[model samples]
Target chain A: MISQNSQTILNVQNLHANTQNTEILKGINLTVKSGEIHAIMGLNGSGKSTLAKVLAGHPDYEITQGSIQFDQQDLLALDSEERAQAGVFLAFQYPIEIPGVANSQFLRLAYNTIQSKRGNDELDPLEFDDFVREKMKLLEMNPDFLDRSVNEGFSGGEKKRNEILQMALLEPKLGVLDETDSGLDIDALKIVAKGVNHLSNEHNAMILITHYQRLLDHIVPDYVHVMESGRIIKTGGKELALELEKHGYDWLHDNLQNNAGATA
Target chain B: MNALANIDYLSSLLQTLSTQNPGDFPKDLLPENNFPWLKQLRTQAIDQAGQFKWPTTRDEEWRFTDISPLSTLTFKPAQPGNSPALADVSPFFIEEANNRLVFVDGFFTPELSNVNHKNQLVVGNLAELATSHSDVIEHHLGQHFKSQKNLFSALNTAFLKDCAVIIAPQNTVITQPVHILYIATQAETTHYPRCLVVGQTNSQATVIEDYIALQKPANSSYITNSVAEFSLAANAQIRHFRIQRENSSAFHLANCAVSLDYASRYQAVSVTLGASISRYNLDIGLRAEAAECIIDGLALISSDQLADTHTCIDHLQPNCVSHQQHKCIADEGAHAVFNGKIIVRPDAQRTDSSQSSRNLLLSNQAKIDAKPQLEIFADDVKCAHGATVGQLDNEEIFYLKSRGIPELTARNLLTYAFGAEILNRISIASLKHTLEQIVLNQTQHH
Candidate 1:
């Protein structure tokens, strides 16, 4: 459990987002305190990924209403790269493969972009080499990978690992992992979970969006939220995940349908 | 500008060609005794060329490239001259060639040519072979490609007196490539050269057509009108390479057409590095299902030179695939043009086609015009086309420079990477290596 004195790092109120002209997220209100691990679970068509993308300021998704606050500042006012510089990182569900851009070069550019935004001196290539080497050691990644093109031919597990590596290098205050464990194997899941666990600190927080309860067995979220349709239907402690795993989402889905029928 | 519209220039050019009595040439070069159809074809082509006027900028195809230098030249029909004594006027892989056919001033020289592998490869002049092997020549010659609306092709077919023909039998894979060398020795001269390659079912072969100018001291202008036709039978494969390195004062216009049968594969690779004004017309027709065609080419233009390539790939059968990629590097007042079109007929369903053209400009005065077009009539097909013309990426170059690489080396490395994608598709190791070296040398010199 997070301490009561932990400051709130993210405040989202009545948020609504859309792509083109179709609305995905209706009205979402959520508050995330620092140093806490939260998991958002939902079905395939629900707005879980939408919320993650909206928070990251993806250009395609427009916010129709409401406001998002990050660390006492307006988060919606920032662009995608600016949000990245402001200590907010979103692990893409499907990472883009940018050919001709080397992995090491991309990481260094991203790192310097964020660091310079914070008024920190940028590290030279040699300095960055040393810094990333240490971080890669922690994640158990091979150093030779730095020379390859960014995600050009990487396997699903390797791509997820590379995302975590970027997260480690940036050290953002709020890291949103959008379905990072979807395609990972057992060993890969353990390594990714360990990387996330080691990066979480008193000044940072994480929100894991997943569809399966199998991932929670390793990541061990402090808070769990069940989302249906376009909003969260239930919020509880860790045992709630175990309860849902035992009975399955169909029970809760049927219960919700019956409740709606009764109310009507 | 219609700079060559002066009637005086045309009259003077005709006079110069008629006055210079080179020697007695064979009037009955294409005999009517055998392959009489070829004689009729030549007469029709000459009539067509005579009726059509020289195109200027008013024509859509010649809008970007100017052919005034070609029209102003007094070009005479070249007769058979002595073979070039130097062997170095050949391509990179000439000595190891299984068969070499040398043509000097539009006439075949059998003594200087080498046909080392007897039964595996068949190489000889097209006119001579048409007389000796009339049955085979009449059946296969001029069966695939026809004279289009292009004037250069009409003229080439009109004077189609000298050409080379190569035939590989079924299931025979020649170990060494066949080389076709066409050397122009005199200026103020015109040469019409044609080559026909027929790969039988299950046969595989590579052919390199090299165009070179032997004498550099000639002050007059020259014109080379050429055509090459390739036919690939079912399950056969052919790799065709064209290397054009003519004189700086020369004008070269070439047309290449290929037809592929069921399950056949055809690849055309062109490297243009010489000539003051050059134009290449390439067309590939996928006539049967499951056929594949790839067109890969590159041009390095510099010093007031103009290079243009126009290609078209037609998918007439279902389940066929075609891919084309061309790159141009222009610098120092040079100009380059690329126009590629891919068309899929209504009955050609499940066709997967893609075309891309990329240009890199090194100087502010250099110019490039690239257009990639696609016309799809089938709804179930996948088609895409794209063209990009821009300077080098500043951020990428800066990143490399910061890593201790000099600015020039970084730029060269990035440019090499841009062209490496197409080079990687070459299956021949030695050819690929030679091309890489040429690209490196060109970039460094620029």
Candidate 2:
């Protein structure tokens, strides 16, 4: 558990969610605080991505029994856009292709929408172009990217970089990167990690959901949590990620079963 | 009941009138003129119009649109009134359109029109052309289009008293577009707005035909039946755009026919945004080898409005190419229909043609009917056609919402994107922007 004195950005208690009546997240309990970077690692079908989607208020999942608090507000009660405006940002693993809409226009609309919600003056197209270009430099994206359609025909690495670029512009209080490192090469992973690191601050928090420990090498996390069967089974320092990477999740499964037997 | 549900209303009224034993030519609608040839042409058209029945849902082409509301209405011929207070015409008037011909209530409005460089081209009334250029008008008018299968066109030709006529001479290049605007005013009246364009050999021209209403009429509905004919000579190039922005209560039917000579290039774009019940028929004929034609259309309708577009391209000679794409957006019980056909003659070998119809339904109640047909008799011809009808992908909607756009705004953006695909292809920048704004406005309601 994170310290009580620290400002908790997100708190999930016994969260249960499913789609089409098939339960995915059985009982997810986690706490993320400001200034902390948490890495959630799990094997396939372990509800890792589901946790991220559920946090973003995706309508596909039905929360049977749970409660989520973000910045001390009832996050679960808000819709997806409301949650987004409330400073909860999720960098999707698969960014959708929106044809016929310029990327710059989409980014400006999204930026202005969040800015207005924060009671800040929104930037127009010219100002936004200047601001977004500066951020694109951090990700080493080409200037032509702003002219193309949103994520249309973008390479996998380019899509990941685009997600991070959006995060840089949005500057949300709590950002969740779901499998952002899954499809990146080493070079793209470094650039993406650097972008995420540059955006991180003491006033904000981040949760990186990945299957590999490779991303942890670049964007180091303070806490590493292992999720299996929709629940966080173990929590440790960043060293745990390396150990899990070397030993695999089978060790943790055995350890979890043995501990349950001993307790029973 | 909604307008589309009672589809045969106006047709039934016309049927009643025809059964009452009145003469074939409705006396009040006929013109008293000196041109014997013109009078004979109208008489023949009226006789033909009475022989064919109004299309109903039973007809395969009109399966999705029900025109009962139009058929039941009792409408007289539209009469020109004191040019009513002008509605803002800035948006519809393109700056690049140097020569503009404005018609109000099917009558020419001289004060509202401006034609520059009179010596470069001939711009006059179609009726006047019967006297000034009778040989050309007699040879081209209503010759390319088969009016026996088209009732509205037959009605238009039968009452063709006034029309905007444009003639571009040989080897001339008109830099600016010739804009023909037909503004329908008054209610419970039918208007026949017509246009004839002739592009001579190796000439280049662009023509824009716009149909609009100053305001939505109260307590009554009007109808505008328009016919535009284009005759492009060998090696001539003509870019044509037709915009229909009538009042939602008005009924609009238009027929555009284009005849291309050897190696001529023709492009036609239609943007329909208004009218309660609207139908546009576009036909293009490639009479010589190497002729090319492109037809594109966009329709945005909601609130029980119904818009139908039917297009046909005939490949009469060898080595011709035609491409057609039509898009429709329907919401709130609105219905849209798109039917496209391509016919390749046996001698038209190596002819290339492709047609596509894409529709987006904004609501569960919104519906779209799309049919793309190809009939090829040439052994070496290549042709393909496709049609799709669907709603915005739920995943895409969710994706937008997750980025802080509200569901409604996200849906609007997606819908605009869907329609913008066609509008973005417009060669005229100002027209593209204006049409995009209209499509954006349509997205807000659904």
Candidate 3:
């Protein structure tokens, strides 16, 4: 639960983003405070993924209107890398495969870059090897994955575990999991949720963007928000997810249409 | 008039050649000890070269590359004793080479070369070997390369004398590679460097022919015509690498011909990075059954540079295999071309051959033309060929940037990786490492 004294980590107001002159996110508003977990559940084409990408500053999306404040700073002014350095991490739904670069080298470079940006001492290859091995144990990742190309031939579960491994290494202030539960088996989903739970603390917050409430079962969310047509249509406690799972999204869709017709 | 225009450059070069005195050429540029037969061969080649016309844009082989600049300029034969300091050649030198031959302007520089494994193989200057190892040299040199119709090949043979020669005797395996560095130092000068390698029966070896030049001059215009001939006896395995990293304003034309006997294997890799205009012609002839040939190449061109590679592999006997993979990266108005052809003769049944040419264009103005051809006269053969040219995937770039890597770093990494695909074929670990570093540095600079 988010206490009254908890400070806000991410605040958005009337966020609007579009691509190719077609608006995807008409207007979105959300507030994520420290020491809390918020789950954004939506059906297909409801712009949940768009919200995740816009938060990470994807170049393809244009923010025509609205403001995003992270740690009380203008998040819209920052580039993707700058936002990453400022403590925002987005776990992609589909990770990309870089063929030639070894996973260890890429992870080390990213780790050192962020460390140096924060004015912290960086680890050399040897120290990083030991440090990363320890982090990999949390995700049950095999040691051989370090020598292979980043996500080149990894299975779906392996790719998701790698993403969580990076999040554990970066230790960002706010973590956004975009459909992290997709393509994962029940056992793999449990491991991922457990890893995320282990990383969360009082100072860092997380936003879980998912389609199914099954993921929320493993890692219970403090608040549940229903998204429809690029906007948050409903907000409730943890029980809302169970209710949505029980009744499905058809009832919500019918109820929203009837409400709009009645208002007109 | 159109035909005349097609051979205009060749005609102009002939005009310049008609006034030359072939006899007045330096002693090092002629046959060793004035061998009458060798001298006669040179005379015949030069005579034939005089009648042949230089290829022009109208010719299918030279369609994408234009040699108008070479036709307009007057080039003098490069003289000896004008070599740059050792510091200038050190960057191109590999530390792992057991035997090395350094040639400055086509003349062997003994002071800078090192030959230590005399017991395992014979490595020395070709001119001296022509006199000392006459029996071994006469049977192989100039015997395998019979057709001198190609202008550049004829030119190189006509003016070649001080070449590098490596001979691995029967059952001999040279662990370390033989490195030959050919360096050019002057503008408006032409250098013809030749290399001959004979691997006897059951012999195995690797040879690296590295072509480089001194730092860029005010007028960085020169010409290098190089030729290398290899003879692999039955059961022999030879790996050859031809690396051309010359000055940006230079023009380089080279030909590498190989003849393989039964069960012999030959892998030849050509890496072209420097020179304003560079062209490589690779020809491999599998004369006996079970012979395997692999021809791989990579060209990285930028800033108005042009690099073209033409490869031909002939399977003359049955049960032979040939594979070719050529890649090119063009950026910033550069142009790259690849033409690969594989021929399976009528008697060469059960021949397996594969050819691929992949190209990446980094800029909108960059151009790449790749043509992979396969001709199979035999009924039972497995032959496949393909060509592709495209830009980097936007999704890849965005993915990299999403990981906090800058756009420039992501591009460089991707470009370097693309070139590394071919470099990975190199078996020498240190050479691969050095080439990777060069690829990284060069790609980042662009």
Lowest summed lDDT window (length 10), candidate 2 chain B? B1-10
TM-score of 3: 0.84
Residue A64, model 2: lDDT of 96
Give the proportion of true interface contacts each model preserves, from 0 to 1. Answer: 0.00, 0.71, 0.46
Q: Model 1, which residues run further than 4 Å from truth?
A: A1-264, B1-23, B26-35, B94-96, B147-149, B218-221
What are the TM-scores, per candidate, against the unseen true structure? 0.65, 0.82, 0.84
Report the number of clashing residue pairs per model: 0, 10, 0
For model 2, what is the error of residue B151's alpha carbon versus the real structure, in angstroms, after optimal superposition? 2.0
Model 1 C-alpha lDDT per residue in residues B6-94, reported as the tens digit of each score = 54334443453335332434443555445568878766765565566677788887788888666655566676655666555544446
Candidate 2 chain A, run of 10 with poorest lDDT: A1-10
Say which docking band candidate 2 falls in.
Answer: medium
DockQ of each: 0.04, 0.56, 0.43
Model 3 lDDT per residue over B1-446, tens place: 12333454444444444565656555454443467767766767677676666687999888888877777556766777765777766777787788899988899888888887556888988776777777777677666667424878887776666789999999998878899999888777788888889999999999999988874465478899998889999999999988898888999998888999999999988899989999888888999999999888999989999999988899999999999889999989999999888889999999999998989998899999898878889999999888889977777777666667777877888888778878878888888888888888778843
lDDT of each: 0.79, 0.86, 0.86
DockQ of 1: 0.04
* Local accuracy of candidate 3 as per-residue lDDT tens digits, A1-264: 577888999999999999999899988999999989999998999999999999988889999999999998999999888888898998989998876678898898788888888899999999999999999998989999998888989999999999999999888999999999999999999999999999988899999999999999998899999998889998888898998998898878787799999999
